[model samples]
Target chain A: MTLLHSRRQKEIRKRLEGMRPRLYRVAFAWTHNRSLAEDLTQDTLVKALQAARQLRELESLDAWLFRIMSNCRRDHFRNQVSTENVDNYDLVDERTPETRSSEQQLIQKVRDSVEALPETHRQTLTLVDIEGFSYMETASILEIPVGTVMSRLSRARARLRKLLATQHVDVRGNDSNARLRRIK
Target chain B: MTEMEHITEEMLNAFIDQELADNDMMHVYLAMSKDPDLRDRVCELRANKELLRAAYRQVPAPRKYQRPPGLLPRTAMAAGIMSLGVGALLGWYAHSFSQSDNPPRTVARAYQTFDSKVKVVFHVSRNDAAAFAQILDEAEALVAAEDDKRSNNSVRIVANGDGLFLLSAKASPFKDRIRILSEKYNNLVFAGCSQTQKRLQRERGLSVDLLPQVSTVNSGVFEVLRLQEAGWKYIPI
Candidate 1:
């Protein structure tokens, strides 16, 4: 039993080492700060090492790690509010000037659209739309019923549609290309 | 791109992941046949998701791990050294606070105003000096760019419990930067919990320096609740 436990621990470490880079990236995306993401990743690894014994046999390691990562992020965010005095920093990708401008506009539009959503709707969309969590997984993570997730997601999508439609109308301004783009 | 008229983001996600139930799949197909706008929105959302995923696919893991002290098996000599150092730093910072004229109320008010403008909280629990330093740098950069109009715009850094380690002089990860930021941004306040300090002193003999900008509070959790009551926005970074 001791030998088996030791072997399992070794395997977990190896698997964790392999997944570190990817986990860090997700953390980075969540926090938009390299250092915080790095810290979160390390903390996740350390906790994973400690609580590894509790992971049941049926759970996928990847999913389990992701759950840990999400919890770490939430905890970090909660602590950040209590400990550090700083503003929410958004991650802006740098591309070509034209591309950057367009992307920025799109991102701003999307952010505004998302921000307008109620907290529940926003979380559902963010997890499903932005973070790529499945309906079932998001439900589990959020500790809500699945039907609620679907309903919130549906409302979120409808709100986004309205926002996009409004933006399209404002941008067209009767220009042929703009109008064509809007219609298309 | 025009073919986008037949898909919804939810439908596309479902289709891609093969998660749509039989009834939902039929509904999606029927909806696609009837509504182009739904399809376009889904396409746009799908494209955005793909772009975001591609942009942030690789998360970096730390190459070198610095184990925190609690995790390490302590030698008597190492423990003694840490204890002595902690004692001295704590005494020094406490003395400095006693000598200073800026009362707690003034500091609290300044912090309150900062919270009104742009409240940010930093969470640090790791003993890694480099990592802690980087967190301070990020906070410094953000505070530097903050607007001057918001006099109440404050950053209260509450380091409590294990997080108080960041304030230690010997192991203080962000001492220099914390000092600089606290000075420049009067709105920036660094605080460690008194309880944690006592624990550090009694158990580990480690003393945390409470620099002019850094102060010791009764409890970290209490500080969080107070600032939150004062309407400071919270983020755990």
Candidate 2:
């Protein structure tokens, strides 16, 4: 029995191992803090392994792992919100170099826009667009209805467009070339 | 276009995502063909989705974590200390178990049965013996690890195109490993594409004999796609 139990754990580890990158990506996208993302991913993995026996089917593992991650992230925020002021997280450093290229600036601007979105919308966008999950898949991962996923995704994209416009990056994540356009 | 309601953002979003019903999808397509404004909106949405995907796809996966292979090994201790340690361990275990049972904050689906069976489909388009060997190694590792978790496991290596060469009895250098893997893992399978075989016959007038362990499939690409639709993770090698 001991040998058999150990064998089962090895298998669980392998399956979870393949998902590390994807889990980290989702975690990093959410937290925008590499260390926290790593921590979250690690914790999620541990919890998933402990609960592996409860998993009834292999097909649901992706969504199951993601759901655990989603909860882990939320719990982290709840603990963080009570002790720290998360409002100042957006304060930018004024000492940044001026030699940054327009491309870098546009990338930064897009990142900021995505990071500023409401948590639900950001997650929806990340899972659907970045992760290439279908609407139903995203819904399953987020534990929301398909309609909610659609609305959140739509709103997130619209918000990103508006936010990027303010930073002078066009909706497509490029520098605005409107000034170069010939006036018709 | 003139008779219908103006396209709402939701409708346009749905169209962009290809989530619309067939009639509605056609309606949007027809509208875009005639209305440049509608076309531009779709373009904007497409561009936005593209930009988002490009930005996030670059984030690398986490460094591979090295976890202990199993529970910590039992240690030797004095009898009194051992008794004390056992009690503490039991208490800690109970606490952790209860904590884990808390209603998960996110929406969770019913436990699925896939836990009992892991389905993997390897798409092999090359005949590299070295690469195929690596695949077998990975599969072996998976089977070993899964021994405790599921009662059954499935790993399929679908060879097509030039990849069929890896399974060819006449040319494969790793024939010994392939045979060994087949003998060891009853759940593992090697599949050769019949379509590729037919093409080879027609184009080169060559007939290939696959290892006896390999089964023939109608089409490699079709098999991969079908397996993906069936929820098997597709690993392209």
Candidate 3:
């Protein structure tokens, strides 16, 4: 309507752009497939832009975007969940046993362990641990009770610890060629 | 010091995650200090969370987003940001006026009035009553002078920070005068900055109630920039 209004709209557009990588990481965690994750991220952003006016508070932005992403991810799997290829999950370590740097292997193991978790628990864990969302915000994003979020997160962590046998994360990407760079 | 048997895994998780309330948080601290095993268990859960956080932060190389050109280009109701020279400013002014709810003749009449007057923006970011008095004096005089000639020229007062007092419903001393002047001048706008309002609430726990006649913008500084970019004379008070 006015340049001032356009500039304000552009501010929102810029914010959405800044959120892309974070959205992708969450999406990737959900789908365990890069392209699907990318598509989910892209769709979530486009939907967010279209529905930007509906968002009233900036403090709730992370929860709001993740909610949109959750919807998009749900919509994607709604019709395709059963028919989707199980082997398409390429989260396995890409390197040969000799060539595999332990860090890459650990990264793959983390992805696999997380994927093995129940969907609700995995969502709670990633939202809290990875995105640093507070328990309340995670509850809102996942549309569950705070008590439920805490329980799911607790179960997820316990299962992860058992899966990895209480392993601590110490491996940095010591080798450049064998490294998985930090994303989001 | 609390008993080792008292700490549940949920409370330990909440404590390690810093999700516990202040009182319970202290309770966990007391228990952990009293019991070595409790501390060790909290440390383990904390470490596991850190591990997940770290591992997920790493990933394979990403394919560039094939974002189509003009992913969010201008819509019918909105336009792109245009460089405003002397002519461009008037054009944009007229363009904006045209889009307003005013009738066709009013748009033309308002354009003429805008062209004749030097548009003004008064910026206030302080609670100094003296400065506010000066701003009110200058603003009232400017608009009243234009009223003598029967012109509805535009003026804006963009306030943020402590300057928001000028628009505060209960705090503003010149509430009656502002209401009177606003009623007299068709295009005089009083805008409060939302950023400052949010900051005040978050930091100082103040809930600001603006005067009924005033509107709000995302940022007061941004409003100043908007007016100046559109060729309005900026007078910071």
Candidate 4:
């Protein structure tokens, strides 16, 4: 029995270790900052390890770790203020127009649009669309109903389309006013 | 737009994602066949999903992060093996090498006496091809710097999890490069975990054949622990 228990424990550790990259990737996507993502992943791992005895079903480990990560993300942002100084709108693009490829610009635009989404919608879209989690799995991770997941995902996708379309217009030599309109 | 009234945007989204029930999917398909507008909406939603996926695919995880100290006693030992004497060294070496199935061809030059001994273990856990390449570059640079200093350095790269690609016989693109490195540096060791291999074989039904130069470790985590126990630096790549 002791040997079996030890083997089970080893299995759990290996599984958790294997999940590190995935956990880190999701955390990174949510936070959009490397250090915060690392902190969240580390916290989630430590918390999961400490609470291993509470895990009744090994099948639910993915959801459990994600729940911990979601909570960690919530707590982290709760205490912290946004880094952006909203009034300072004169931030220059470091890459000059000639140097920036069109494909790179489009990718950057899409990235910015996704990051601009509301937290709930962004998380939902990321899990459902990018991470390819089922609605039920996403709901379990976020501690929300499946209905809520569906609604959030739909809204996120719709908003992303609008945001991308608006950006496409702005990218076509539109002035600052057009850019502001798109942002609005 | 009038034709799309029967199918809500959310329903269309669900249909595109295949999240609809079989009956609902059939309904949507029937509706789409009659309605070009509805079909266009579905196509547009799919395009959006594909675009979103493409954009996010560019967002790679950060190269390095601070891995928290493992909480379990065994895990703590695995993550941090400190101040082990010569006795522990010999025991670990023998225990590691004596494992059945695939055994390491040569004992790691870990315990060799040198003027300045620099030991590093690069833990691979992600399938990031670029990151893996970067690790090899860093390893080569370390060797070059150590050589310049006339120091005897040992570098062991342990592959587990998704990083098993570093030693994969069938699918690894880095096999030849790993071979060249081994031939060049007598001090360098490449280790693949038997536990991970067995798990892959059992779960994924993949019988991974490790390259000629690579060695099999009982547990990559434990091998890391043993190396760290004997004054080796631990780095996760």
Runs of candidate 2 exceeding 4 Å displacement:
A2-10, A85-99, A171-184, B1-5, B60-237
Across A7-57, the per-residue lDDT of candidate 3 in tens digits comes to 655566667767877998887777677766766775686567546667887
Worst 10 residues of 1 chain A by lDDT: A175-184
For the record, the alpha-carbon RMSD of candidate 3 to the native fold, in angstroms, is: 17.5
lDDT by residue for model 1 (A119-148), tens: 557656666754677888878766789777
Task: Give per-residue CA lDDT, model 2, range B21-94, as digits (tens).
Answer: 99989888888888877777788888778767756766633323323356332321133234323322322232
Order of the predicted models by lDDT, top scorer first: 3, 4, 2, 1
**DockQ score for model 1:** 0.09
Give fnat for candidates 1, 2 and onward, in order. 0.12, 0.37, 0.37, 0.40
Give each prediction's DockQ, rounded to 2 decimals: 0.09, 0.15, 0.16, 0.17
Pairs of colliding residues, candidate 4: none
* Residue B225 lDDT (model 3): 56
**TM-score of candidate 2 against the unseen true structure:** 0.52
TM-score of 3: 0.54
Task: Sort by DockQ, best first.
Answer: 4, 3, 2, 1
- In candidate 1, position B182 carries an lDDT of 74
lDDT of 3 by residue, B1-237 (tens): 446688776777788789999999999888788888887778778766766777778655344343345665343112222221232333334334434675433222333444466577777877867656656655665565544463555678889889998789999998997899789776778899887887788789998989988999866765675575466755554
True contacts kept of 2: 0.37
Task: Give model 4's TM-score versus the native structure.
Answer: 0.53
